[model samples]
Target chain A: MSLITPEFGLLFWQTLIFLLLLLLLAKFAWKPILGSLKEREDSIDNALKMAQQAKEEMQNLKAGNEKLLADARKERDQMLKEGQAMAAQFVEQAKTTASAEAGRITQQAREAIQQEKNAALAEVKNTAAQLSVDIAERLLRRELADPTAQQKLVDEYLKDVKLN
Target chain B: MKRLLTLLLCLCTFVGFAAEPAESGEKGGAFNPGEIILHHVADSHEWHWFSTDNGNFVTYLPIIAYQPGKGVAAFSSEKVAEGKTYGNFKLEDEKLVAIDGSKVYDFSITKNVAALAMSSLLLVFIFSSVAKSYRSRVGQAPSGLQSLLEPFIVFIRDEVGKKSIGPKYERYMPYLLTVFFFIWFNNLLGLTPGAANLSGNIAVTMALAVVTLLITLFSANKNYWGHIFAPPGVPWPLYIIMVPVELIGVLVKPFSLMIRLFANITAGHIIILSFISLIFIFRSAATGLISVPFGLFISLLELLVSILQAYIFTLLTAMYIGGAVEEHHHEEEHGHGEDFGTAEQRAGGSNVAHLNRPDVATH
Candidate 1:
């Protein structure tokens, strides 16, 4: 019977002790401990967030570098292709100019040969006419060697010219 | 095997020594196990460690009694040893009584009060040092005693506080932590041989329960009172019975909490004492074979019960606070349409599909 009953003295002490404990612990113990725990959690969370941000920034930087490298490669290829085309054009132009020079020289030589052949042909014709004139003059002189023949030839030529 | 036999022998030797005085002291040659067990479990002015034929090992506590007409008188309890009387007072069945037929209020430093003081001091020392460590070792891992108790503190915070009290749990943490460790430490202390049964006492448990009840009542929101006074969805005709029942339920929660812890710890002590009494009741050394092992087993069980009761008390306190301060949610109101779905709402969720089914089916 006594075991189940509550005593006033014990109750008073129990309540006093408990309330004091609650106050003391709340002020001195739990406040500091819980505050530190929350602070530690926040610090850790911040560290992880910063690490994630840094990783994203590194990825963006890498992507930008890759894009720049690709653009540089494309530009180099463009320059290389232009250089090759220019070299090809220079060779073609040089070949065309050499062919034109050769053609002009050959035409000039052919014109000079035609002119010499014409001059040579004219000289040969003039020499043949001169030789014929000299031969005729010698033949006339031999025929008039006889005077009476010559005079009768002159008189008959004269009577014929008068009768006409 | 040899060690174990020696330890058992030591236990038997202790039981034999402790039981003889109970058998021979007050009741002639006969042994009264009930009297012995009750004396051990009850509060007293003297701390009795053990008894032998030569003498008894005891510490007489201080007595402070206040008479209505007269002022307070303080003296050593040794002045009233073995049916003796002091100046105007006498010891009556380990209680202080006045000889002049007047009522005296005893505010002595009884066994339980002393034990409470010791345990509280110990708690303050341990926690203050731990608190200091937290200050000194900022941003570093807890070491030594700090490391050991940190897990339990976190468990009570996260598991008990956060889970029970929801978002506003921080406000009630100081009370929760203090009560948890106080109960736990005292429970463990009570398990020591010849120690005071401080936590098992009804007055101590009552004080704790009263604190919990007060906190719950003070922190209770409008929603909590609303649910109690006028339950949602209940017809007005049922309010006559429902209102009284709801009010009683509020009280019964704390009342049950008090009795549960008190009965558990007291029952553990009685069972252990009863087991030791078995050897004396039979008056044989062979009975020790059964009594010693059973007593040891119950003591170990009591160790577990100690922490378990502490956890339960704190958890229920947190739950009560949680219920009191919980904000009204529309989903919970919907669930209350079903008569007994509040518990189910708490268990599963506020949004049970079955709760919404009737409205949907009608539509």
Candidate 2:
């Protein structure tokens, strides 16, 4: 059996065929196949990397948005506090002015009442003097009842005035 | 109905063709199992599918021989039917030797060559179709044969090429893919009834290995040869011992590549043929029960082995070339050669082994 024996004919033919097949396949089949395979693999890698980057960017954006929201909330609280303090200040100023005006008005009323009291006493004195005079005059007029008696009284009064 | 009739007719025709061979082979004699197995595995100058009672069926291939005096003696192999002579040349001891005891150079298209041709044509047709599909169906789900072959193509590239060869895998990919399909298809062809044992032939294996060796050697950078001749981290006195050792390894690598494929394919064929021969040796109808099932089991195993062998061959080729052309930076980055993964470690990885690799998985 020539089983283990390496024949020259088969060896030559096989080599020729193998080389030819390798060259032809390399040009036609493998070139395109390998090219496409590489193309697909590279694209897949790119897409994965891009997805990872996008995820990171999304996380960053979320954090930034939170920070912005915090800032806006802080500014709003500051504004509200300032607004409340201004309102309290206006209330305090209005109370002070109103108290001053009320005090001045009360004092003026007291002075007017004092002046009216003095005037009322004076009027009472005048009324009392006029009442005494009217009473004396009524009594004298009753005592001297006739006209002759009145004339003798006038002469006696003139003499008495001269002696005085 | 017409399709059905045609199918039935084809089935009948095949049965007729198949049936006649057994009857003639019986007349031919109870087959010697070992010889029969060897005959199937060897190269031949004719293509014999089967035989009939009237006459044996064979497609006589062309005989191409070159002798010193005759220059070139080319003729149809039919001239040497039953080992006849033509122009002082005859098939002597299964070789195209001159009848006058002169040396002759035979570069004939034997049965294995025919197998190679057939497989090549088939490969071209199949791959071109897949290529066209790839071109037209970019980014879409693969359908038909494209779907079937795409995963394998991707596996060879990623697992075998990218894993073992690292970044420079693309350069060697064309040759890798070519050899992968070539060996794979030929191995498959060998399994078919009436097909030549293409990958089983030692010549075919040697040719493929030679190509790998040539590619590896040619692409080898200074670092590769340097390491082989004078390895780093070894004592200076050890160069005397290590240089030859490393050199033998360089020689042995391709030798192993050749033998592994040849032995594996040849063994599978021998086993299958032996199983088939058992039925004939026993000469009992009942023997089919013992023979057919065993043969089938072995054949099915061969189906996996054939593809596996092809993958191994291509993967090793990539690793070799990867080692050769590897930039020194790669080893530095990975720490060392063996640290990346020994060839044995890579072998344990089946066709889908890339799925398990942490690096490949990340990709």
Candidate 3:
């Protein structure tokens, strides 16, 4: 079956009715329809403008975020550099303190050893002096006890000793 | 330069043909309308000797015998008296003046209106497919045919109806869309083989132009009527002259539309046909060889023109609607002028009172 079966009489009537309907539409419906279209167009334009503004705002925020990130990175780098310098200074200070403590301990040990050596030498010297005194006394006593022989010897000695 | 050369060649060929006698002494031959119409309308496979199925009778229809030594031969019908052989042929004037041509007849082959019906069905099938796609999409985004049509629909809405009819554009959208599609579809169909005659008919164009006229008249605003009758700011004498002129302009606009479309489409068809007919006229192999390239070139140009004509018609119609519904800015200007005049009058009266002194005037 053909889709477009154009009946002449039918088409004529349809065309006439269509024309009349168009006239009616122009009279009654045109204004409201046009008004709605205008509103739609205006809304679309407004939407586009809003979208453009939002895009611009996003771009500005992106730029701000980039700058903040750069500043944060700079701060982190500065902190790292300062931390490295402080760590180096701390290590030097610790080494100086340890060396000073070691030197003081060694000096104190040397003084203590010298004091002990002096005490020991004085004690040895005192003992030797006592021993010598005792020995002299004993020899003198022996000589006194020998007096019996002394009389005879003295006569002979006096003659020889006249020169003393 | 090519086109000029072709024109010269055509003129030379026409003149040469005119110089030769029409009667190439072909016997029992006459021009038949049925043959002529059939020859023009149908697709010809090869040039052949056309004759009634009974072999005895022959006519002066130049038969391309399609043989090596005999490419073209004049055949005589048995209806002719028996002793005269093929040598009896002669040429008289530009037309094929047949010797012993005893009868004069005129007739035409009836065209099949069924073809037009078929064309309409084809149109419905194509558009229905597009329409079906649109319906299936429902609330979703348009795809396929809908995608193609949506832009054109939106273009009409945004560019033509909205911009032309202003606040009241919605009601006119349906009409505008119908007209644009109808005209464009018809124009495209007319480009197909055997379909050129429909658009060539003036009646079709007239009906379309009438629709445009009715829309403009009915949708016209108060400003449009005022401009037609009193036309603000024009002097009385000039206004009297302009009143009829503006009224006539209303009628003439649609009339011009009708003529422009009908003439352009018809003329293009005629020019293409005329170029194709050149091969038959020249009869020389060298001339026939040149016609092929030239005919193809002209056909290509016509294709571009066909689309262009449809666009121009639609665009102009939109412009006319824009003119009809647009508000008159001159009326506002007139009101401002009146206000300025009243202000000047008040100033003049105050100045006169301040300057009033009888004694000074008498002195």
Candidate 4:
């Protein structure tokens, strides 16, 4: 039947037209369209990958920053401890030097006072001896001066002196 | 949807009336639905839209015929109107025939040819511009026609191409996309009243199937040939039967592709025409109640089928290509090679099963 039959003319035209359409569309339509579609997809995928990488890099930088802060904090703590220790050491050294100087000054003053006291006591003893000696000499000289008067009396006492 | 239904209803009514008197007066004293349906479904030398008492509205195409000794004769089909003889040639049963018993080769540009050319141009224009927009838009969101057509292209690329054809899908994208759109567009175009049933024509579908077959056979790798000739784990003694079966499977795939599309489209047209023919057969105004609504329903269903058949064709094409180029893993060959062979057998077998099953009401 003509219903199922395929005429040569129609077949010829169908084949020719279909092939031409395929060739034309392949070169003109499908190539560029599919190419751009692929390019867009690749670019989108690349962008996502780059975004992931950037996020990771940001996290790394944050972690590095936190580590640096911690290190600085540790250094500050160590420095504060070292500074307190040095200040404590300086205070101890100053206290020891001040106490040592105070002891030396007190000992020197005590020695000076003792030497002054000895010197004054010796001078007082020497003056007192000289004064006693002058006073005794003066009293003896006065008694000798009274000896002439007594000589007359001695004539009376010659006999007693001779007897002595 | 309503609008389209109304338009379809008017067109179907117009077509039914046009063919009624012409068929009844020319053939018998009664209407012939078969003649009307076949006339509508088959290719013709002219594009007939409607007929009235005044004259018939048609476009006469160029008729080119060649005889072995007489050489080529070119003339407008209009010259052979009303069964008139033009030179030694005349129209006989919608064919250009030689008068003197000489063999004639008709190379006429029929209604289908013109429609094919028009659809081809339309395809070219739509896609070339979309391609241009892709160039211009570059990283921007698709707009208008680009956005509209992008999903279909991507669907064919992803669902039909990648999912069906695998990694080697890219190479077949052009052919796949072209065939899909070509079939889809023509199927929709054919649904409109009295339009040339270009997609429904056997010759057109045959050409498409042949191309798919050629591509499948040519692009097929060593693995495909191996499966066909040796069938992997099959006993060599069974090659006498298995080889022929495998080879028949190869030819049957494309043959079915051709017939499936041709039959489906042509059937749809026949069904709609038959529904419209009911009113005249009964010769009653009351038949309008039954005819119009049923015709409308079928036409709307046809809209869905047009795209569906196109998708099925392309999907199966992708599957065939995928099967052909598929590689056998070295591990599978040594360990579970028999199972692997049976798996391949199941795939090929299921496809044939799908083919043999009746299409039911969907077609």
* Winning model by lDDT: 4
Ranking by lDDT: 4, 1, 2, 3
Tens digit per residue, CA lDDT, model 2, A19-123: 777777777777777677767777888999999999999999999999999999999999999988988888888888888888888888888888888788878
TM-score: model 4 vs. ground truth = 0.74
Give the TM-score comparing model 2 with the true structure, all chains together. 0.76
TM-score of chain A by itself in each prediction = 0.62, 0.52, 0.49, 0.62
Ranking by TM-score: 1, 2, 4, 3
Stretches of model 3 off by over 4 angstroms after superposition: A1-164, B1-124, B138-143, B147-159, B162-167, B282-287, B330-363
Of the true interface contacts, what fraction does each candidate have?
0.77, 0.64, 0.01, 0.93
Screening candidate 4 with a backbone cut-off below 3 angstroms (N, C-alpha, C), the clashing residue pairs are none
Q: What's model 3's lDDT at B360?
A: 23
Q: Candidate 1: DockQ?
A: 0.54
Docking quality (DockQ) for each candidate? 0.54, 0.43, 0.02, 0.62
What is candidate 3's TM-score for chain A?
A: 0.49
Summarize candidate 2's per-residue lDDT along B52-111 as a digit string, tens digits.
675656767767788877788667777765657777888865678777788888877778
* Winner of 3 and 4 under DockQ: 4
Give the C-alpha miss distance for residue B46 in model 1, angstroms: 1.1
Question: Any runs in candidate 1 off by more than 4 Å, and if so which?
Answer: A70-164, B1-23, B26-28, B99-101, B332-363
lDDT (10s digit) by residue, model 3, range B37-102: 333332121112333333322122121112233233323222122323334333221112234553
Overall lDDT per candidate, in order of appearance: 0.82, 0.78, 0.53, 0.83
Identify the superior model by lDDT, candidate 1 or candidate 2. Answer: 1
lDDT (Cα) of model 4: 0.83
